[model samples]
Target: MSVVILTIKISHFINHVNKMLGKVNEEDLKSVIDNTKRLTGNLARISDNLDEKEIANLIKSAVAKS
Candidate 1:
């Protein structure tokens, strides 16, 4: 996927999470979002391309880090 698409996906996830639960901690949510974006950027640079597995791994690693 392109950076634009990846960014959209991340935004969607954040919105979805926010909608599903009330009273989320702003700092924690932002941390997750930032880590996700960082991981996506790293994986994109690593492969210079996007694939399902790469995207999945990037998300997994970011979540794990958090």
Candidate 2:
């Protein structure tokens, strides 16, 4: 029950985001997802040996570069 509600809410949220962002092209969306996957991989690797401050700094740097 909770999962279904969460899925519907998430679907609505994504539609809202698309409307606000002016409709991203399919290729652009795919590229964004690819980049996010790479970022998540980096975060996972960093988490293994990095401290909290270091992880925060990494995220800030990634946001700036992105």
**Looking at candidate 1, what is the lDDT of residue 53?**
88
Residues 13-37, candidate 2: write the lDDT tens digits. Answer: 9999989667778889889999899
For model 1, the superposed segments whose C-alpha errors exceed 4 Å read: 1-19, 49-66
Instruction: After superposing candidate 2 on the true structure, give the runs of residues whose Cα lies further than 4 Å from its correct spot.
Output: 1-15, 18-22, 64-66
Error of 1 at 7 (Å): 25
Tens digits of lDDT, candidate 1, 1-66: 999999999999999987866676778879989988996678768776777888789779868998
lDDT per model, in order? 0.84, 0.90
- In candidate 2 the C-alpha lDDT for residue 12 amounts to 100
**Every model's TM-score:** 0.43, 0.61
